[model samples]
Target: MLTGKKTIVFGERDEISATATSACLKAAGAEVVYENTACFV
Candidate 1:
């Protein structure tokens, strides 16, 4: 559903769900970016 879309995922840590979501996005041909919550600290 998210083809050729850009997305950013922010979270405190890289959890299982986060990883799975990223994989799903990639499979759907999306450019996924990840940011850790600690970066804002």
Candidate 2:
């Protein structure tokens, strides 16, 4: 489990999955910097 750690999640295509992961990380005491949903062509 992550505790007092910083993280950034990029290019998460699924909204539910992204939100869930962010929530889990925060609950585990992680500082989520950013969550991006955009993709490059």
lDDT of each: 0.66, 0.73
Window of ten residues with lowest summed lDDT in model 2: 10-19
Tens digits of lDDT, candidate 1, 1-41: 69988888554444434566677789999988763343333
Give the Å error, residue 17, model 1: 1.8
> Model 2, range 1-41, lDDT digits (tens) per residue?
68988888655454345566788899999988887665333
Candidate 1: where is the Cα deviation over 4 Å? 10-16, 35-41
Model 2 segments beyond 4 Å from truth?
14-16, 38-41
Model 2, residue pairs in steric clash: none
What lDDT is reached at residue 27 by model 2?
A: 93
TM-score for all models, in order of appearance: 0.56, 0.63
